[model samples]
Target: MATPKSAVYAASKHAVLGFSNALRMELAPIGIHLTTVNLGPVNTNFFDNADPSGKYRQSVRRYMLDPHKVAQKNCKKPL
Candidate 1:
């Protein structure tokens, strides 16, 4: 899912995902649980700065997830 102009951003996200997966296993023995939610572009003000031109935002508008709904889903999950 790496895009042409987001090499660093993509790498950092991958790094975090790997680290979280490893940490989740390490902590499971102690009854700690970890959850990682991989989401696509979220509908938020972030695009105002990140995509100031609005091109990217417009392109992915239909694919964007509502922030409130995402939050509600995660919050409802049992921990």
Candidate 2:
């Protein structure tokens, strides 16, 4: 599932995850809480905007997450 086109995006997310973990540790001493929701690709217009050919959308349609469900569950409970 790795590709040259996604390397930058993946790397940036990795950086953010690492940064958030470090921040969480630092903030723990002050009783500040942090949460990270790592939801995979959600059903959105992202495909329509990014993939005009619809090939990518078709390929991942089965695995795509539902944005509403994701938001609802996250709002109802913390990780």
Candidate 3:
């Protein structure tokens, strides 16, 4: 989902995924675990700043995830 203006953001996400995968392998033998949650945009005030015009937010509102629900699901899951 790399949009036209989000090259740096996309690259940073990829970098995090790469780093986490490497770290997970390195820590597995010691019983340490890591989890990466790659999710689409959530319904939040972030859109107020990121999309001041409200067009993107309006377009994606129906598809946006509930932040609380997302956190609850992730927190309750076994790592």
Candidate 4:
């Protein structure tokens, strides 16, 4: 159950994605490449102290992927 706070966090990540895309374009002429590993809901909090005791949170876990595995697999993509 991410509320208003998640908007800011999600926006920041989207901004980063745009920046990376532009950077890849700029460097492509020099043979540089980039890839964006867009992440979805994972088992972590946007804010460390965020409450995880709610039923919403509990249900979310049933579909949540492990952050470690996400990182490992995504890192192997061209970036």
Candidate 5:
């Protein structure tokens, strides 16, 4: 759960998780693969686009993940 200020982000992520779970179950019988990769904060231009003011980005800079590292890890062991 996110703080009140980030309720929208939390809700949207939860919705994606729920939908992915349902889709995975539905496709299992059909031998279809459904990989849902839930990535953490990646260091990218997303902050510039999402929060141009940089207020939120600066506040969470320490928590941001490295996009290249994340991609490497995902490639090695995807979910």
Candidate 6:
């Protein structure tokens, strides 16, 4: 169980994504619009890199993603 201490943050995003995916499938007959942004790494600093040892720093940094690109692609209004 790879549980992160702050999983709710990831869960909220996943919930919205899951809802949209299912909703889109359900509403396809009616010509409604939807998109699910299944995203990967973006260049930003959300992870801690304070370790003096470069090994841990490098490993830890992989978890983060750039908010700018995520916002640009994912900021659907009327949520």
Q: Which one is best on lDDT?
A: 1
lDDT of 5 by residue, 1-79 (tens): 5654567888998899899999999999999978887776688997787778888778878988988787777595754
Error of 4 at 65 (Å): 0.9
- Tens digits of per-residue lDDT, candidate 1, 6-38, equal 788889999999999999999999999999978
RMSD of each: 3.9, 4.1, 4.0, 5.1, 4.6, 6.6
lDDT of 5 at 37: 76
Q: Write the per-residue lDDT of candidate 4 for residues 1-79, one digit (tens) a residue.
A: 3355377766888798889999999999999999887655677764245554455457566777787787777586643
Error of 6 at 63 (Å): 9.2
Which wins on TM-score, candidate 3 or candidate 5?
3
* Candidate 3 error regions (>4 Å): 74-79
- The lDDT for every candidate, in the order shown, is 0.88, 0.80, 0.87, 0.70, 0.81, 0.61
TM value for model 6:
0.48
**Which parts of model 4 have CA positions greater than 4 angstroms off?**
1-4, 45-48, 51-56, 71-79
**Clash totals in order:** 0, 0, 0, 0, 0, 0
Task: For residues 1-79, write the lDDT of model 3, one tens digit per residue.
Answer: 6765568888999999999999999999999999998989899998898768888888888899998888788686743
Per-residue lDDT value at 58 in model 2: 88
Question: Tens-digit lDDT track for model 6 on 1-79?
Answer: 1134447757887788889989999999999989776555344443343333445436655664666756766567622
**Between candidates 1 and 6, the TM-score winner:** 1
TM-score of 3: 0.69
Kindly report the root-mean-square deviation of model 1 from the true structure over all alpha carbons: 3.9
Error of 1 at 8 (Å): 3.1
Model 2 TM-score (2 dp): 0.67
Q: Can you rank all candidates by TM-score, best first?
A: 1, 3, 2, 4, 5, 6
lDDT of model 5 at residue 74?
57
Whole-model lDDT, candidate 5? 0.81
In model 3, which residue pairs have backbone atoms overlapping below 3 Å?
A: none
